[model samples]
Target: MVTLDKDLASIQEVRDLLNAAKTAQQTLATMSQEQINKICEAMAQAAYDNREKLAKMANEETGFGIWQDKVVKNSFASKFVWDYIKDMKTVGILKEDNEKKIIDVAVPVGVIAGLIPSTNPTSTVIYKALIALKAGNGIVFSPHPNALNAILETIKIISVAAESAGCPKGAIGCMMKPTMQGTAELMKHQDTSLILATGGSAMVKAAYSSGTPAIGVGPGNGPAYIEKSADIPLAVKRILDSKTFDNGTICASEQSIIAETSNKTAVVAELKRQGAYFLSTEESAKLEKYIMRANGSMNPQIVGKSVQAIAQLTGLTVPASARVLIAEETRVGHKVPYSREKLAPILAFYTVDNWEEACELSMEILYQEGAGHTMMIHSQDDRIIRAFGLKKPVSRVLVNTPGALGGIGATTNMAPALTLGCGAVGGSSTSDNISPENLFNVRRIAYGVRELEELRETPAPYTETASINEDLLVDTLVERILAKLQ
Candidate 1:
């Protein structure tokens, strides 16, 4: 309810925050690994401890997503980040050498400026702050106006742990108030060595194009396709769980469903079983036009409405218990506002007669909202999944699971995260979930040709006679051996 004046914080305030972050980065560089781990653990514990409070804050502030699901999101950010970086060596001295020759090292990238979104405010607040700390970098946060209070409070909790662990004061600094101009200032600040940006297209674009280097995430228009081979019932159950969770505020949540005509009936039945209510043809036609703008953009008013609420918005009557509002098969690229990430439990369905049609329509739907985001297909057919993955123009193609949670595990078994990086077409550099590893840098030590022998003086490539000549060879022989030396 508190609206921040754009001028609440001036240029001087931004300067102070930057100075503190720089000091914190230096402090981190001098800290021991034990100190780093202690601080990280404290952050993880604080997130877990305040899960309920954090969820409440997010729901009340954003008026989007369910509270319980936000709890899971916050907990995931804390625990997953800690586990991902636990074994990662970022502290003290990490030296790769030939026997003992210095090769590559791990170096922190100075100060990081992070932009937290309204959708997953507290989770991202903790996640970005912790990752920067893990990398021995100081961090500054620009919270979305909708979730500023939640973000600032979370930062306070983390600052306590960081300072107690001997981290330099101001290691984790955030603006008491943020504005369009203020955020732009932070992004362009020379003191901010790195930008970790998440949110709308304009913000991400600014971060990427700002002379400073940044890791930017794009918008998500994840589409779920169900082929003939899929278990219609199971797919429906999983899709409903993913779509309805947190009122579909997640960027990776399923935006559209493409199912085979043969399985449409069965899928719809299961969807109903999972608390979804299917609308009549007339109802869908009315809602479709109502939810979308003439230009095809989603109407913001419908962004986070519940299934039943959306039904009412279209002049239909559905029980309050309904978790998902289903609109029957529509043409590909149909401009229904409902398909454009309502951020709610409303699902737009498309039925195709053949796999090719399904693929084509699924890609079209994804392109409509997320040209470079994520698409998922639930099927046992590797060929189908492979086809979708290779051809959809989407950054990520998840198989057999919902786009929101399952897509995060596309490259690793890491916990399903809230932040997804929609790639180029989707207007992002990443095609997968953003993780802490992205925040760190890998410093390489290249030796001059003359220095190569000296660098590897003590290390023998191969013990055999043939090996000696092999080691002398460049491409595979030398490079492979050097790679193994690490």
Candidate 2:
């Protein structure tokens, strides 16, 4: 009898799925915009119907986020995301400029390899499927080991509905056995036209290094600055609501709180009133040890865990009503776990002298990490808000709203999306909130708009046989061409 190892099995699975997906993508490439949207609508509807069940499965399998909050995330991926992208054209003629003599046509990007995170498995699967199919690209998902069951079930539901709506079979595939080796194969596969990578920094970095075109996200360590002119109570409420939601699993969730010295007293009081527990110097030390591992990555055990759960893990006595944990700190570095991305119900607090000081501090913190993710500020002063928004390196500058919700466009009017691109500075290809449009490329059909000599301001008088010094001219042209080539 012969037995196969999991790694070989995983690699075989990846090859089979990609081959089938590539064929299906060929059929999708010929689909019309309306046909693609119809199939996506069916997929979205099926996801919405199974949201609760998938959410429960994700929570029970991974034991990361709250099941109830996952339900909301699933709904956002289904209805909200679908509503935002339902009408936008992603195929056929995207734009036609008669005056400019240019016509823009959308082309499918072929097969996409998606990397799913355990933190938001089901929701991420649903969202990626919607956007990928909307653009007429077939997708294959590599599920996180911790959330494989939920992801597989979600894929099954959506893919069935999609096929029912006339989408080609094998257009949406998920690996049954997902391993690191298998994921690498998926990313490096020649049939994979692009990779939509979302997960830990290591996995995202791996995607980029696989010699394939990829769009990835970096770690988020956004700070929420409570300016002096802001509504203190409302600001704190928004922070708590965001932090406690899914136990801070979202990468866009605020990792730290910054306040002007003038508003420090009121901010702290409001934070305390609304279910925040400030850790003492001793307690902070205890929790910091568990926030990150010896190698400095976020500890998976605490990720998406509630304050009570984290406190128990760290052997600290935290109140039952505490929605989040706070640790006042004056330092920022990878060595200091509080200053890094915790991805749990833990926040670091800092105080600045004024708005300008707050701005400087925020910039410094983001520079330390999360250079192109998100930042939040609460202020009624338009001038200050404008100034604050100008210099930040983050992709999104959320104002007067929860970072988790606002960054993902649930609260803000930015595009409703699950994958938020961090731009070039954050190691992502684009800064846009990723949509179906992002999954396809635009091919420009352009007409000759001008004469060749019109490229220069003053034309050398046009005559076919007017030049006299042919030998000298050829020598000069050859030298210039050599210079340019060199």
Candidate 3:
């Protein structure tokens, strides 16, 4: 008896899944909007029913984030995402502009290669599956190895529900034995129509380089700016709420706070009152060492960790009630840990002279790392809010809301999604909160509204050019006569 190598077996598994997904996608592409909606509804309900179970499994398996928060994320991914996309027309004739004599037809992009991250594995799987199937596309997941079990379990639940609702068999699948080679095969597969990649920068880059069209997201280093006119206590509350939610596991959470100088003291007092521990200069330096790896990427060990856990890991002492740790900083760069994205219950504090300077600092922070991701501002002044909206480089400029919840559309009117596209500035293809609309292509049926004569000048019967040629002959003769005379 012979056994296949682990990598080889994984690669073979990917090929098999791709073959199945291809056939499944063909069937899905032929499905009507109602049929797709029924399958999506069933999958969403199943995921919602198993939300707590999957959330606990994710937390236990990956040892990241709060289980209760994971439950919220799961519910958001399942219920909120489905509700948002349930009524969207994604098949057949989507729209017809009789006045303009044009028709818009929705076409599924076909088989999708979904890359799930370890941070929000279950929720991401649910969200991806919902949007993919809602848009009439089949999905094959490449689960992060650390959260493979949870992701696989979620997929299994959804797959069963989907099939029972008339979804094609094998339409939803995950790589049980995930490997780099397997993921590469999945992304580069001939049958894979598009890649919905939501993970680290390196993985997104790999997906973009796989010679396949991909919608990949980038890292988020969102800064929450509290203008002087804002309510300092309420601003601090929202920022803390965002930073501490899921121990800051969500990439869109606030990474730092930029407060105006006039309100800096008040903001600090409010932050402290809300259980944010301000680190001393020495302690700040100590914690900086753990924020990022030696290679300059964020250290996974500190990601999704609580304030107490981060303090213990960095050998610092903090109050037991502290929900977040803050470090004062003035610089923004690759070497500046506090100025970068810390996916934990930690934040960097900066003071600017006024809103103008705050805007400048926000742009500097985003440009340093998380351009085209998200930013937030707590401002009662509409002018200030509009200014930040116009000047910020980020895709989502959340106002007076927790960056984590607002950026993910949980507390805002944006599309509910787990995969947030960072747009061109962040090297992504889109800047929208990814949705089922993004998963399908639109084919335009345009009528000929004008005749070729409308584009032409009726040729003027060639009389105008005929006169010019005739006049040229006369002028040539006169010039020749003049030349001979001279």
Candidate 4:
């Protein structure tokens, strides 16, 4: 692990960074939109040029996610800068009419303090840093211990680019060593204007309670519900593709399945065809005993391993290409660790009698870990899908694709994001997929009620006098009526 003199950079260092950032923000905000676009284009190109190197750094430092997947994540992050904000104009006040009515405009919040997760360190660092820069804010990152190297390396890349582009010299900074205390100091520091937290529940909570406004997200326990109407074979293929992607380290990956009973057998068979090895009841029990703690915390060693790797742990031999290991879910709750976030290639399947049952089971399982995360469904019936969306407590309900890829925008039309906001129900402030645009505010133009005569002729009923004390009239009317009746 890298070491730094913690006492040296203290809270004061963050303050100094903020001061420089504010000056740069003013400069960038004053610059033409053309300049910002040029930087974004350059960023996208840099991301493409260095994708391989960034991916390798993530894999070596985090030791959890795969390199190829990290590459995709970095590319998405880089491209998203263009996708979400490339066309947006944030430099000058937008005007609707010559009535001195200027629309809303975004101003950089000075300094941003971000907590980068170990799961997607490199991508998160790049995404947050670039978005902050684009919004004309200065940023500092506290990388998770598992990904310190990748985080630092990415910082160097971004800082060099920004400085070369004539941005502020210290527009971006990162801690050389990030400890628990160091993180606490950063979040609670007075100069840190906002906290963009992406990680576990504990860190999100800390950010929220740090006496600053924060955008926090909760844990993801994504549940995929397969209605009887879904194509059993296609659904099976999508599920396997999702679960085994990056060995299931994705937070949006399906943690449990609620398959309609009529399709369970067919789905299981197709899953077998797609490189899944089902364990016998006895073997599943033994594997459970060895792979999880009594409290259901996954054994870290088994979390991101492939199915073949997990099978080898249980003295079972599987083909080299086996994508996922499976076991029948006889019951529910924390006792069945696989039904929760195993964060590996193991899957648990539960059978339901009907669509309603499937929805209930899926929501129940998600409520256990998802809370505010998301629920996924596959069915041709739009009404049924809408019903699930309306009834479920989940924040973002996805349909007709693998939970992992669909939720993160890989195989769907939705925005590609690494951060899936688990809304307040799940203890998160965000309820949509994370995007660079979320980091900034949109300016709106409002015209005064100039047409008071037209407003009076409108449908809404209101006494529109040139000067009306509505409150005084209500009180006077009440008194007059009471006096007359007396």
Candidate 5:
């Protein structure tokens, strides 16, 4: 009875939030780009100012990721994202082509349903709010229950700042009482224009199935391939740095390392030199059992955990200096936990005979789970880099950089985003990095370039046409033949 009451309350709360968001979005949609920018600036500053506090709150509430790293993420979501999108035009006439006599107008997609994840709850909220508002759209967040406090706190801060800066009230809101029914209601609501979902595969699938246009990101099991011609130490260092960043909570972080057999010795030596602890056969087996749940999903208890905590959980002893746990793995499947997305400071190591073999291995690993997400290759050879970029089934083929930072556009020229789309190949609607531009639609205005007679002037193939003239000629010939027969 209590559970039923809670669910009913959540559904009612979703309805209220949706109504408020719809009204706020209508007001926001009427504002000019400059006015929207002012509100976005205020919200970014507010989020940046409270970055540390919110990071600590998220860590304390969810017990995931490092507070220090979360601070960096918060800064990225606010300052970096704002800097990248501050100059952009998202309203009114965005483009004009004098020669073609065409104009492009940007249109906001109204209220956006944002699904916040537990790993980066506060930062995700800040990022989504910034992008949604930058596009002159209102956002209603469905926060992860585990990180509700941080999500709500971030939303409150941003909403206050935005309203103070001449933004409409209720432009940014979050579901304080989060439940499955509430989130479903929020997504399927008639007023919800789009869903920007960033969570597990099941949650993303649900978002797509909610009868709303959704840009959902899927699970990432990216593999970092260290070619023979690459800088072994630098590659290993970047991988370790990325995997250990926020304790490997980022989806784009590398889950496995594929190195050429010619460079296997050097790769292993560099990995060990950079604080990687390789597990024994027995240790790997023992840890594998705890990597996934009985139902084959990632175990929440081990996500974003430190090496020491993970060691304790699996009853393995390792040096205090260890930064990441490495397991030599050959198989790739859902049953093989080591070859899957661990979301912690853990890695699977594979050796290949050459770059070709390394490419095949990387493809195999990604196809097993993370296709159309991200892949990294460290190679000085431009040909090899281009080859991987052309053949790999990933949205981002990062070259000579950390997967986590590069994929999110911190170390690369790509758009900075918390939600990285995996594309249709990965069962997502888009392969973009989820920017403000994605939150809006464009209306094209084109003048008639040619006369209607010009279309009829072009000749078509005989087989392509079934015109009335041909039919009349055929009928005439048939009549003539019938008359001759008579």
Candidate 6:
């Protein structure tokens, strides 16, 4: 009897998928912009139509988030992402400037290696597939083992639609038997051009360490600041809505709320009014041990779990009206679990003396974790908003909107995307929202505007005993010639 081990089978499957993606990408590179856009449109439509079904499957398979919220995420990926990129030019000539004598040509980055996380299974797959095809690149997805079936179904739906609309036969692929060894093979494959990594720190780190170019997102512990000049009720509503959406699975969701001491009472009252349950000191201490494991990473028991589920896990009595769990804290560090990225409906509340204190506290929180991910500021004072925007290490500063939705460009105009790329400060290649523009490289077809002598021209140094400055002479002649021509 011949029995293949799971790792060996996964590795073999990854190799085959990589080869197919490579061959398909070669054909994709020759596609016109119109052809690529049509295929992408079809894929987006197909995914959007199956959004609900896929969302349900993701929830059932992974037990991460609500199926309804997953539907919204799916719709954002399919419709919002498609609308933003439908008119984009990703193939052939992109721009031409006769005056500059340079033409920008879009070139696909070859086969892409997409690593999907269990947090956002179907939506991530659909979004990656759209942007990859829009840029005329083929992609192979390595679905997280926890959400394999849902991810596989998503890939099948979109890939079939793409192929029906003139895409290459194997332009999009997914691994049914995902393993660490298989993922390694996919990232380090000879034909793989880029790795679009969206997962845990270990997996993202592995992608970067695979000796391949990767855009890997880091952990997000964004602080939503409620300045004195902000709308208290509206700000609280936005924060609660964002943090509770999909149980805060999105990395960009707010992890903490910073309120001014002057408005602390009002903020707390409003939070309670809006279904926020504050845990006492004892409760916070008990829950802290459960938030992070002994390994110094997030505890899976609480990740993407609801308030009721989390209370049950922690053996605490929570109100049925509680939409989110709040813990008052005065510290920020890895040791302080409330100050870190929980990735669930658990939020830390901090009270500061003023907006300046809020700013410094927010920076401290981000420095500890999620350095270049996102932050939220709700304020009518443009000065304060601008101040926070200037020195923060975060890539995006969402204002007066739900962090989860706004970060993905649903309620905001930032490029609609599911994979939010944290900047170099967070160890990502780009500080973008991960769009088609990030998927392709540009080839500049430039004309030789300067002669060899012009290139050799050097500015003569200023001195008392020297010949006329060559730069001065050229400038004076050029000005006179221009005047005469005019």
**What is the C-alpha lDDT profile of model 6 across 341-415, one tens digit per residue?**
999999999999988899999999999999999999999999999999998999999989999989988989999
Model 3 weakest lDDT span, ten residues long: 458-467
- Per-candidate clash tally: 4, 0, 0, 3, 0, 0
lDDT, each prediction: 0.76, 0.92, 0.93, 0.75, 0.94, 0.93
lDDT, residue 18, model 6: 86
- Lowest summed-lDDT stretch of 10 residues in model 2? 455-464
In model 4, residue pairs whose N, Cα or C atoms come closer than 3 Å (at least 3 residues apart or on different chains), thus clashing, are 104-443, 104-444, 372-426
Cα lDDT for residue 240, model 1?
84
Model 1 per-residue lDDT at 242: 83
Indicate which candidate wins on lDDT: 5
- By lDDT rank, best first, the candidates go 5, 3, 6, 2, 1, 4
lDDT for each residue of candidate 3 in 19-125, tens digit (9 for 90 to 100): 99889989998888899999999999999999999999999999899999999999999999888889989989999999999999999998999999999999999
Task: Assess candidate 3 and give its lDDT.
Answer: 0.93
In model 5, what lDDT does residue 298 have?
Answer: 98
Which lDDT tens digits does candidate 1 get at residues 1-486? Answer: 885455645455778899888876887878777888788888777877888898899889877778898888788778866776777677655667775455666678888889998888998888887777877888888888888888888988878876776667888999876877777788898898889888776788899888888778776767788898998788887788788877887777897787787888887777878788777888777777766667655565666667766666668888777888778666555455655666667777787898899877776777777777777788988887787777887767777776666765523374345556666777676665665556667777765446666776875556546434434565667688889999
Candidate 3 lDDT score at position 374: 97
What lDDT, from 0 to 1, does candidate 1 have? 0.76
Pairs that collide, model 1 = 97-101, 252-404, 292-337, 372-426
For residues 317-425, write the lDDT of model 2, one tens digit per residue.
9888888889999998879888888789899999889888888888888888898999999989999989978999989999999999999999999998778899888
lDDT of candidate model 6 versus the reference = 0.93
